[model samples]
Target: MSPAHVLEPTYDTLRRRLLMGAWPAGQRLEAARLAADLGVSITPVRDSLNRLTGERLIVSQPGDGFHVPRLDEAGLRGLLDWHHAIVTMALGRERAGRPDEFQLTGGDLPERSAHLFASLVARARDEELDWAIENAAARLGRFRHHEAAVLAEADKDVGAIERMMDEADSPGLRAAIDYHHDRRRSAVDQLIAASRGGQII
Candidate 1:
């Protein structure tokens, strides 16, 4: 295979591992070790690491190599803010032809919802914005992997947002956006606390 073709899957696999919280926050990642684990040479692993660094999913420190970023509340807020703006714009544009209520299931609700929002944002016809939304979603790491109650609550919140969009209630949409962020922040806070209470990563 071509170099690009060979490296693309490796990049994707590494991205999935990060998003799934395979590595602990702030865990150092040695390319040589990863290359050995993935049964590949260091070259592809290095290329994949470079791509992840570009996405802000992996941070490279001078003389220290790459590491998964430590979870940060401030960074989370910034990402939520970015998500809010892009989603609001996309919803506004889709208001004229809003579809039926979002049909969300329970298991994997967070990942599914992220995909749904990413799809909605894609309707904005801006590739850069779409990619940004996806990146932000993936960078969420284990924060969204909550209990059943949290997942159910998130499903409900998305339904409310969908209803607001269908009703063309701009104010309601804005409110829903705030509600979503607030709920997500609360969930993350709880998860952080629980993690500190002996739940590793």
Candidate 2:
């Protein structure tokens, strides 16, 4: 197979695994081992790691190869704040219509919440904003599984956001967004501990 063919799948698989927390934070990603496990050559794994590093899904050091980013409280707060800003900006824009295709009621809480945010962001009709939200989401995805463990009524909170979106209540939606992010912001320590102790989802 061509390098392009090998590279795309390798990149996609690694990206999925990384976002899903397949490896713990701060663990070194060995390209050779990953290549062997994925049944690809080391070159493609290295290339994929480099691409992921650029996307901020993976981190690289001069002599340390690549490793999963260990998010400190400050780092995690920065990401949450950044994502909240993007989503809030999208909400402030006047969209032509809702994303009718996104089913907010049909998945696990995290998946549904993701769709809800995607639908909200899609309304902005700005590619750059979409890209920014996606990048933020990917970086934060691994920590999402910890939310349920730390946050009370997590599902209800997401449900309220969904309902606000469905009802076209912009003010309510914005408030819900603030509450959602602020609640998480306040519980950063619990969230970090939960993520560290919990099994990889």
The candidate that wins on lDDT is 2
Local accuracy by lDDT, each model: 0.70, 0.82
Models, CA RMSD each: 3.6, 2.7
The stretch of ten residues in a row with the least summed lDDT in candidate 1 is 192-201
Estimate the lDDT of model 2.
0.82
Give all TM-scores, in the order shown: 0.79, 0.90
Clashes (backbone N, CA, C under 3 Å), per candidate, total: 0, 0
Residue 157 lDDT in model 1?
Answer: 78
Estimate the lDDT of model 1. 0.70
**Local lDDT at 175 for model 2:** 90
lDDT of candidate 2 over 51-74, digit per residue (tens) = 999999999999988999988899
Q: Give the residue spans of candidate 1 off by over 4 A.
A: 93-107, 147-152, 159-174, 193-201
